[model samples]
Target: MPTALTAPAAGAVPPDASPDVTGSDAALRRYLHGLPGVDAVGLEARAATLGTRSIKTSAKAYALDLAISMIDLTTLEGADTPGKVRSLCAKGANPDPTDRTTPRVAAICVYPDMVPVAREALAGTGIAVASVATAFPAGRAGLEVKLADTREAVAAGADEIDMVIDRGAFLAGRYLQVYEEIRAVREACARPDGSAAHLKVIFENGELATYDNIRRASWLAMLAGAHFIKTSTGKVAVNATLPNTLLMLEAVRDFRAATGRQVGVKPAGGIRTTKDALKYLVVVNETAGEDWLTPEWFRFGASSLLNDLLMQRQKLRTGSYSGPDYVTVD
Candidate 1:
């Protein structure tokens, strides 16, 4: 069995955190393992620190969630409006209609059903087609169902698959159940040429409050062959949070330290501003370093975030902040 490394205490301050961690690594670890509230990671402090940074550059890249309504076909219909997506992509993926073009976003996420639409719409462009499969939002189905879902999506030409873990099974302590599902999904993603769709496993951290559980979930998912371990599905109330992300990054750090795997990290859901996006980037920087900066390792699954980043980028290029309606979002 693998022994747990000595990390900062639960709800305790990180060594670099403003508030000093209170005890020996072992005690802190135990405290963290048992609780659902704050661990050595000070969420408020981290959020504030990230907020203070000046994000006045066009250097940052983003990934847009065009098809987020997994269960609602009605919403999915307009999720990635080809005209809007084309327009957005043309304008450096700027969500604000008023801004000029710079460069396009790294990828455009959508439902597997809409892959053809996004592919045709974004053809001759660098933007990729990311599909959400395996009964997302509420993955309550069986492996066969999920496998068939995954296989069909990949066959339809999906470059990536963002799968949601079965919350009911995971919450029931069935780690292997969750692990096997991801493994099967990945296998289904592999094409005859041996190439595979990028596999991003959603941990939905807002639902799991304990740092240990988050870390455990990350490791298990990575071990089961997840290319990226994401934060949330954006369907839950308590979506992505800094502390939860910090914990996941620590796992990524540890995983890399032990096995040299360069897994990705994504913080999705409710990140409505450029500031939040920057803070997430800062956390990724602090935890996983510079390697995870690109679209390959990092993606923000947001509908409203791109516009804010665009607006901020525009303000830097131009001279003033745009209005609430300044950005055109459909």
Candidate 2:
């Protein structure tokens, strides 16, 4: 998604009124923690007060939010990304494209190297160029090197920089160190003109896999100055689950309540169908409320998922699938 649109903001009305689904909170709470295949029990008691206003205003919503923050969602899907980019582009995939007939995502997230390609492809289009830099996918490099990569990507025209945090440092309980690293990277995102590209810190939540871990990570990331806190790299087992998502949403809410700063949340990875997409939408709706409904605050990092969403949308409007191998490339 475009950082300009979804980056965390500290100012919102924090409406004092409640949503219309006054009595649904309890029911919603029951449903959230009782989800199949995963345990929502620990979170069930915490998952309370959900509704349109609540979801729009929900500090604790029901479903998980999809962080399709990738512009090049599948530019590197298989092993041959360049080839895939060319092939998909040939198949009508917008190297940089958007439209009402097509599936428009939050941003054209791509690798730093592909930023220029995406830039040329999306030039003049409203979609922003989001690149994964700062030693993305594994953020294992040195700080200077990471900062340089960030500079290069931004200089190359990336509107957003999706950097992965040092999982080792985080897991080791070196929060201050992790916080400083993220803070430094965020600074690099700031241009000489004082404007800055948005920064999304990938928690790679699959590895953390605990509500407490997710909560702790959320707090650190937001405090470290992340525009958005992401779930995974879309390359892990526990990518985006309802339970983990609940924790993150609560983290965002608690953070807001504690700091008066409204940080954004992005549940990336493993989302591949409209049904799942809708579920994520439900999560965002119930948790963050309509306030976070826009692309800025919400995103789904998916490649196959877009096809499903487009197919479902087509089906909903016309009552028929777009057929197999259907993807809104163009």
Candidate 3:
């Protein structure tokens, strides 16, 4: 059995109001089960309503730049090489080499083994190196191996850790086990200064398969110590839809209302164009509100999305559309 870390008192909300869901497994489970359930049709309808927002001219330009800055330019694949990571980092550092006005992306997300390569490549550029850990895309490994994965990334200077939750456990009614894994990964993210690398917990909502499960997983992750609650690993088929992302936005927004500590939201997978990215911004704007607009609070996990944004950005500046050949293949 995994030994328990000293958790906060049960049902105790500290004066700071940070989420204090750490307690006996039974207590935590009760708390999670007691939370209200989600209404799928209502939720999807609301998301569709938010998606109808129209952005234009200067507003479009601002939204475009904001979207660019909020991107977690990603390259998560078995085929990832050092040279590929280096190239990705450079693109993230200075997205538009021809136009200096282009803002750098929020971070460069990669596998644990590639953290050092990305860290070195993005050095002094204020761009963070984020690594996917805890048996990313699938959280099927033992606790020890998962922690080692997180520690290796942190040791390699990963400014952020994106850890996936154990979907199988959650589905099997092992909620406490899922929460405990997130808590353990959170502990592993700690740095020398007592501060820790930002932890983004991927819920794998596609697998969770219901609005209720996504909502439960969001609160569960936040309670366990997720600084950011993400939508997917981008490896699954139903990756990041407008309705799903909106649901997560609502989760973070409500979690803040209940606990003073704010959490971020990242919608990974299949968000390919500037239009799709903008609609998500509309969800954040209309749902999570303006406060969630910054990179610190929200992110889009994508690689090809960057090139699309660049093409659109060029059209905005040059008054002409640019083809795929004009942008870097990263």
TM-score of each: 0.77, 0.75, 0.93
> Residues 1-330, candidate 3, lDDT per residue (tens digit)?
333323224343222224543556665566665566667798889988878888978798898899999999999989999999999999998898899999999999999999999999998999989999988889899999999999999999999999999899998878889888888899999998888899999988899988878877888888788999999999989889998888888878877876777999999999999999999999998998999999999999998898998999999999999899998887
Ordering by TM-score: 3, 1, 2
Mark the 10 consecutive residues where model 1 has the least summed lDDT. Answer: 66-75
What are the clash counts of all predictions, listed in order? 8, 26, 0
Instruction: Write model 2 residue lDDT over 145-227, tens digit each, in one string.
Output: 99999999999988988899899977776655676788889999988888999988889987875665676577667756788
Tell me model 2's lDDT, rounded to 2 decimals.
0.63
Q: Which candidate has the highest TM-score of all?
A: 3
Taking every candidate in turn, the Cα RMSD to the unseen true structure, in Å, is: 7.8, 11.0, 4.0
Please provide, for model 1 over 1-330, each residue's C-alpha lDDT reduced to its tens digit, 9 standing for 90 to 100.
Answer: 322334444543322211112243344334334333434557556656765665434444332121111111111333456565455444433334453354456666676776776667667766666778888767778889888888877888878888988877776776556766777898899988889898889988877766667776776677678888888888888778877777777767666765666788777787777667777777777777877766677777776666666666666667887755666654
Candidate 1, position 210, lDDT: 61
Q: Which sequence of candidate numbers ranks them by lDDT, best first?
A: 3, 1, 2
lDDT of 1: 0.65
Q: lDDT per prediction?
A: 0.65, 0.63, 0.87
Worst 10 contiguous positions by lDDT, candidate 3: 7-16
Off by over 4 Å in 2: 1-40, 44-74, 77-83, 86-103, 326-330
